[model samples]
Target: MSEQSVLFVEDDEALRFATVQALELAGLSVRAFAGAEAALAALPTDFDGVIVSDIRMPRIDGLQLLARVRALDKDLPVILVTGHGDVPMAVAALRDGAFDFLTKPFATDHLVAAIARALERRALVIENRRLRAALAAGETDSPLIGESAAMVRLRGAIERLATADLDVLVEGETGTGKELAALLLHRLGPRRARPFVAVDCTTLSEDGGAADLFGHAADSVAHTRLSRVGAVVASSGGTLLLDAVDDLSPAIQAALLRVIEEREVQPIGAERAEAVNLRVVATSRGDLAAAAAAGRFRGDLYHRLAITRLHLPPLREREHDRMLLFAAFVDQAREALARPDHAIGEAERHHVLAHGWPGNVRELRNYAFACVLAADDAPGEDRQDLPSRVAEFETRVIVDALRASAGNVVKAVELLGIPRKTLYYKLGRYGIDPDAFRRQGT
Candidate 1:
């Protein structure tokens, strides 16, 4: 996801306001202007964001702004909005390097999808430019590779909250890189040199768990005669990451709450409580508050750990990032296997992009490894990378849309944001039985 702001220039106040609101709601930072002159005045020559403008605006129009933008930065993306009569003009702007053109009265989906793709392209351009500069300076950086809007916002959120010194609660589905976000938080914060201790609650035992967390001296418990170093004490002056905190036993939760409240840990068998100066970062794939309300988790603990929360969007909801991530994973896999010739084809790209990726990044990583091996060693027709994967994904989407709309064809079309004719063609092309979904919906 691109965090770069979008510059929206439209003379129509109502359209500008509505579009701006939609874009912002879609997680874009927007700068809306009444006309080209105002937008141009505000646009810095080194602006990193994409420009979206109406072509028929008064005085200096969008094309004029596009020309000026080209003079400043030829690579800067300029998307133009055009009326029915301005199609010719909008088409001509493509020759002059306009990123894309959207017709007036286009559906919200049309505009949004276009803007998202454009921003993803803009992010690549900016990243490439940065890489060029870095290479010239003999520097290198590892970027979290994703171009989807969800990823863009995730990166932005991490950067913004990294320095805030707030205890963070990260929530996401399994394999959504919750721990990765926590690592970034620690890496980018004041505690870079400190220990980042991660404990999987699922691995904690009821017998030894509490002792492992709060530390234990010999003779404190029936488990052992030897003293133990717990995560809380071990993580002092650093961060204690609780992976899957929802699995933390209620007794442990209460103890954790005390640590947050008192800024200290009470080690078992110790006469006095020990002072602790540490940050807590906890991750959960479950609905923690609901679990607390359901008597499965502690409410006070929930509130304490949720000082600053970050939710990582699942891969299915990350849109075009699927392809981006798959490519990165493929590159990693190829490099690991010492086969630089192993590359993803267009069919594989389509399949990756269309896949639901139920297991998120982990699943994608495995698929990337599999694809690399198969494409490298397997004979022609025996390879697994094919259009069948794309077809299956398409079928799933279509079936879900049909189920969502019940037996209503028009509603299904609207749900999928596709034209009625196109929907029918896909239904026939996939040989989908929409009646099955209609019955399921009923």
Candidate 2:
């Protein structure tokens, strides 16, 4: 049997023949059996399709077959056909992980629709398993791994700006790899041999921050008696990274602006200012220009830092890079934890592509690590009950239908065996924009 072929088992010969014909007519490849034992015998451990069986079969019933299938592979999807009297038993089986249960007089369209969804999910499962296996032999050298147009442009800009001895402002949303961009600039520049200093502006104390950034003479203030070089002086010949510069207080901002303007630092309690060669790379999570205009930041400092600005693309904007990043993080996590290779689930892959990663790369990396740590865990890293799982599966099915139909609501309605109004309602509820799939297809 083909990998995508379905195994249909029913004790009633006429019903089994009729259902098999309906499935085949729906363009599915199915193998019909008169008993669960025969179907189980023919089932493959890596079956990439659904199993449909009657619940009231002699000896090996649908529930017993489902248990056996679960033993073989818990990921395998099993659909049971239950009579009116057996509805309660079918519900219990669903709690035990039955994929879907159809009533005895169920329409063939419903069965076909259920099978289509099952096959789509199974395909994702198989694909993820293949990717996991490939990860063991795969590797990436660059810290930035992406081939999207935005990423390509960013790379070219980085390469060009790396050699330019100019102060840079790296701006983006949180977790967009602003620091990584700064480091790349430093690494690819003439200042590669110098120490790269990174200071968290948010952590700097209001009173002691100046002393920390601009060096202090011995007995400077009451903090310490020993002489100390601050981050600026220590990074005189190197590149200094000011992280979350927007979070700095007004006093610290004024002090920093002076240091940038003079290209010199005067230690606290010192008599003379010392000249220094420096490259400053400041990162912000907000629009520095807007902040400056609003009087939240010094305009002079903003202009000086904005001479060479690099904005890292957020994860949502880097459409093609999502999977590349996810695969890399998965491999990295597996190696770090010394865990065996593991597959990502259908829902995880869906989330990777569909969800707007507000936290960008950082959020995706954390999710990948969590997935590696717990293979059976839900993609959201939370324990999901049956209803949540069902909802997730339903969403995946709708998305897949949209993709297959190239985002045409009419076409998707036909493919999903649902009303156009129902599809639209679900789309709204799930916040799925069909135009995205349309663009992808084109």
Best by lDDT: 2
Query: Which lDDT values do the candidates have, in the order given?
Result: 0.78, 0.83
Residue 366 in model 2: lDDT = 98
Candidate 2 lDDT at 211 equals 85
Which lDDT tens digits does candidate 2 get at residues 1-442?
Answer: 2348888998888888888888888888999999988898888768788898888889898889999999999889898887532434755787888888766566788788888777877787777665555444443244777777777778788889889979999999999899999999899999999989999988899988888798888886795799889999888888999999998888888888889999998899898999878999999999999999999998888998899899888899987788878987988898999987666666778899999999999999999998888774434522356666555555766776777779998987876666788888989988999999999999
Worst 10 residues of 1 by lDDT: 381-390
Candidate 1's residue-wise lDDT over 192-293, tens digit each? 899999999998887779987899888888857988888998988788899999998878888889998899888888888889988899999988888889
Candidate 2 CA-lDDT value:
0.83
Sum up the clashes in candidate 1: 3
Question: Which prediction has the highest TM-score against the true structure?
Answer: 2
